[model samples]
Target: MRTTDLQLASALGAWRRPGVALARALADAVGGAALDGRLRVGSPLPAERRAAAALGVSRGTLTAALDILRVEGWVDTRHGSGSTLRLPPEAAMRLAPVSAVGEDGAIDLRSAVPAAPHTAYQQALLRAAERSGPVLAESGETGPGLPALRSLIAGRYTEEGLVTRPEQILITSGARAALALLTAHLRPRAAAVEIPAYPAVLAGFRASGTRLAGFRVAADGWDLDQLHDAFRAAAGGVAYLVPDFQNPTGALMPDAARRTVARLAERYRVTVMADETMRDLDLRPAPSPLERIPRAVLVGSAAKTVWGGLRVGWIRGTAALVGELACHPLCEPLSAAPTQQLVAAELLRDPARVLDHRRTALRRQRDHLSGLLAGDSRWRFTVPPGGLALWLRLTDVRSDVVAAQSSAYGLELSPGQSFAADATCAHHLRLPYTSPITTLDRVAAVLDAACGGQGQGPRVPGPGR
Candidate 1:
């Protein structure tokens, strides 16, 4: 796990800030990379001389930066070997559940996952327990997934206008696992991805050595011409999309755009991997892209709609492709825990009721947060019809600087650059509305203080619980 000088330099993008010290900026960039999972633990850094040359810095400056990292527990240097990336215990805890309140009660808006529906979940758990006797008798290994669960997932697609069978479904630990398995199976030379996508997905593609051909996704929606151009450029490669209430941005692609994307994918002979993890969280009516592109492999997860703890997700593809993935070397022999699968099945049996409850709660939170930010002239954002977060455009402040300053106000934020394929969205910030109304109320105050609000402005009324 040795990092090349070039690789290290690329990972440490735009480290030179105007007022920040050179060494501190370099160290902070390295630490940010570690937090973003771009630099894996135990990966030795390139030699000091090579790194200095790659970054166009003097050896002394590079040494000072390494010293900073060492003190912060982001790096460990042995006598012979160079510094290796690492995360201190406290820093590691930041990667835990997104719902976790940080030390001293810091508000973390890093992830867009919602709080679970406790009543529905408890009822489902009770049903799962009742059904566990028969499942317990069999060997715990259910390769493709529990038969009932797979059938339910397949039926979901069938109802959505994509004809599917149980054989077309392959359950995985989570949506991330499903993506990893697809990446390994496809083995594409390159991939066409949205400019600002889910960070983990970008990191996974980069780690796999896949050349990324990024296309811009504006706040409004996708640029079809650019998408077509990217598809033509990366012909025979893979195209990863989040067309249903896209993450971070929450822009839903219209049916016309879906047809265009499907046609472009076909013309270019490219493989499409459509992630629909956020589909069920729709705050409004939207058409499914699966209706237009039957060849595309669909990925869905219970993590967002149900509970992240469930860790259940599935891939919907052709029967033959599903069989191949089930037998892939990287595929886990069993899916998520048997009990969790049963719970998911029970919930899926009457998904509308569960989803209605979730949508109502989310809609309230989303509107409350939107109202709070709407009064602030410095911030501008469109209220997305559906999705868990608001992608905000800061008029006069850099998102990274705002995020750093927000920390002083007991807030944790993911700067927009983290979502970019090449680390370039400095003017944006993603604010999730998954927190309680009380917490979201505090968010307005925190941001106001952090950004130095011009005046009190007109405060919007909070949505009552």
Candidate 2:
């Protein structure tokens, strides 16, 4: 779908700020719009001279802006048809954060979960173990959650500008569990899920009998129109969104779009579930407040930030709603293990350390993975600002096919097709760089071979390993 001039103008509201370079601003505005779903991927952008004139800038500036988008994978430029707003894929967009380790025999590059900062975790665990002994003996099917952890979780959100109370929070086994509780409680007839979503989330919605209407999320962001349209099409039901550093794609929902969506949700009696599971892994300052929105539920977790093994995730909403949700049969008496709670609480006590350690460790791993795949032209690694893995774009191939072949090469990779709501994203791959740097080298080689030397080789089927 080619973006109309008026559409582009609206998305680029004030493409030119006083001191900001016109070219740079244009690129950011367009990229931001694409990332948030206001602009559709593959939508044709205005011609250089025409766009420049429309935005009251010189054609040279527009050309430079397009170059920026091209380099960033926001748009694809062709000689005759001009540039198009696109979410083709990204540098590391193909990677998914997985827990697979090479020690088990497979060079698991299939997932993008962060490598737990061992030293910090070891220290935190020691503290938790010491504290858990006393806390574990007296728990009596603790309702809502471990009180201290819930308070801590609530406090964490309070600090982030979201008003949350322990009473308003319900701790579950994991993010999936919390989501499952929400789906069960709301029991919407239909819902809209932003695609390239976490697989388990999709599963949760389906298991609860909610028909999912697909909405597209690009490497840049989401198309708000698709989001709003999906909501209306779904009769203003529930909308499940990963607004912060979304999994697989690494696109963060902008603040402006959040406001608009919040209004739309209220207007349509829609329930928006914002999953902030990766919010803690963000590499930069937040573009918007992670505050509670009206008629919405906020899901957060320490699984990604602290340790995935510690199944601690929560849902924050009005007391009435949370109370209702807690009664759902799906919401069992969840006493998230005492030790895990203690470890989480201890870790949460020093939010700065968790943030710093995650940022440093993930950044290092991202750089390591990028360096390993840097020479592979067929795979473009866009160092995401935050998340467990990189979203990679395959030059010309089906990700599912690539994934199947990669297994024979001893690489456990999750194909991009697994992340999309349908088959529209088959040309991508998710590579979670959770393994050690040394292990990543082996992963790159396996990928290179599986791709058939620059990804054009014949598909190699395994002989039943």
Candidate 3:
């Protein structure tokens, strides 16, 4: 088994199974697929919890299946490692549909994580690995990442009409690390964020010891007037804005509003950190404020468009600020992983091919999940123009209650309040459909059952309701 196949230490306490029954059950389901020419070598198995729920078994049972696959030459087990399919690449195979959560399993749709894709990308990694030694070390005095990567990333902004140089680019581990460095350098006096901001960002700002002041995103879009007032209130410090395909509410700030907010930021002498991580995924044209506001720090990542495993992201701002942020990164993560950067560079080189494949797959999965939600009237969601998740509201105001009950049925979820500043989103929930199309269906079925199905219980009240 390849070293990358497992991060075994993580699998120990939570995943080890003692009985053969659990092992036998797992072997039967996944093994049956393998022998039937379905699951192939290099294919990634679903997470143990996900697989167990889908197969109507315990995690121990799922581990046993993996163990069996190892014994029968259908799968290989790596110590403190990941699982791998032992079947040959030439074997004819079909994706066996599996649910994100089964009747007896807990489905976590709170975060944005695609069910890990099969090992097609492993080919890119292996190819990169062969050239790793020299290429990885050839960055000269700059260390880690090569000049070519920085140039390629800078080219992205140049295409968008912002002239950027490689010297001005500083590649980071991900957007999260980029934000960390930004927060590290800045004084955490008073920072402004959308009322319901990305929870992690809020946590990061809090960790920086910033007094977080919130500006409410209007139900329709960004509340520019409130945003302006908040900036005026904070006077300076930093203001975080997600102008396109925003998390939680899926609100898109109009270009005019964006411009207004930018002007306000300038007027108040505040720095606008515009997070565009989810910007490019828009199914529609998303007007960006950065076009007119050059001072805005554009924090972006490949994690959204490509797989999160790539972990390559960049930050764009004025040359001086970018340089400052670049220097700060050495104190944090230093640089993005050499191997991941190479893979990302390859995908970026031929973005159309990768994007086409990703969009096609995501479109299918998105539609399937939407269809499932549409079948049930107890849930309400906006058909987002773009972005990874759907913000759903229940017909009843008891979302926390429903979420607790759903957990009882083995379905863990993100309650709306978790994403809010004051935790007032008690009536809401964020449903991210990042699992396989089959899993999306299962999640919908479980949600439908939880909501008491079509006009059966409380009618899902609209936003006002």
Candidate 4:
């Protein structure tokens, strides 16, 4: 593919880190493009002087950047011919996940998965294999799910204050599959999901062709009034709620709010889908009302509480509704991955031990991050009770600018804009303190430098524009 100076310039211009050499930053940008396949291997980079002019950088600076890329083996530049992306097409296309620091030595905070305790997880797997069942006869996919796993899940829910039965369960491939299946079942004309929701939820609605509305989660907790308004605004459509440990923000809805939300869902006659993936991740107990409502469907997953790679999730609702959801074209019968199911069930057997261990470590990490941030005034946040990351508001800086520029400083961050339904939280950022404490120390320093020009104020989390 032929490339132009304008295209390179456009891609490179988005990143700008203060205190970093212009050439180094530009090199990281160019390298990122090459790794991502935007700069095809056989395609020559734009003519040097012209590329520099187009990118508004001095020609010398551009040459330095090119040299860095050449040294990194991403590009090969000839005296007479222009530089070309050196990564082979197939290799580039199949590139491994780029490390946050691999491009420019940035500390990575972008990936949200938590580290599972290796010993505990492996032990569960061993126990599952020991208790393995005879291989079932050949059969095509059937969706109601493994009878054993469903029964285990039902009993688990019952203990959590929600009375459930195996008939009310529908096993899904993962949380995303559940969302997609639910979306297909509702066939909504309109929808509302908490702003900064799990990205898969947004993608599900988009794929299902539903127009969506958003109401923000208050920084402190759920704002029932906003949620009610959002539900009412949806008219007769559907609403997705993550009342426990909401992603990005980590706000656990108070018991009062949970009942109020249930009331609003009924009052507005909207089908409610509550995500309980994070409910199990909480250090303390939160409200549980999944068994109370008829129209509201509840989904739970092992992705958060257990290992993320475990592709196991389930939906809880009336038997009839769950039966209908199970038949969704997207639903399949991996519900009984012999090893996966047994491992999850074994872990479920000791939920308290596993969750308690995770909560204790997470709280320590959270406190470590808070202590690091005590002297910095550029960003602020109320420490979440329990969640994967810190959702912080940049006091006086544009989150977009900092996020864009942070790549240059060796830190890859999720800009708050990605979570906003309307991209209005450009001044916010979600930083994971879940990483190693030593790593968090470096991240704090980098963050402080990045927010050098940010303002001083607190902005309420509200519906983004």
Q: What are the Cα lDDT values of the candidates?
A: 0.80, 0.72, 0.64, 0.71
Residue-wise C-alpha lDDT for candidate 4, range 72-172, written one tens digit per residue: 67787777887887752222222112342233344667766664556677777788877764423325343577677889999987886778899999887
Ranking by TM-score: 1, 3, 2, 4
Ranking by lDDT: 1, 2, 4, 3
Candidate topping TM-score: 1
Q: What would the per-residue lDDT of candidate 3 be over residues 331-440, giving only the tens digit for each residue?
A: 33646777777777766765664454455555655665676566455767776766677777777756777777666655667887777766767778777765554345
Off by over 4 Å in 4: 1-106, 136-142, 284-295, 333-338, 453-465
Quote model 3's TM-score.
Answer: 0.72
Q: What is the lDDT of candidate 3?
A: 0.64
Best-performing candidate as measured by lDDT: 1
Candidate 1 wrong stretches, greater than 4 Å: 1-104, 285-292, 455-465
The Cα RMSD of model 2 versus the native structure comes to 17.3
What are the per-residue Cα lDDT tens digits for candidate 1 across 1-465?
Answer: 799999988877656644457898788778767765667777999999999999999999999999999997889999987788987643532322334233235777787776566667787889999989988998877788999999998997888778789999998888988998899998888889997899999989988989888888865899887888889877998999998878888988877888888888999988999999988777865533434455788898988887787788899988899999988887764367777888889988888866776786678668777876775778889888777889999989999999998777677789999999878889899988876544566677677766775735323222221
Residue pairs that clash (backbone atoms under 3 angstroms), model 1: none
- Model 2: residues >4 Å from true position, as ranges? 1-101, 115-119, 122-126, 129-139, 285-295, 333-335, 371-377, 455-465
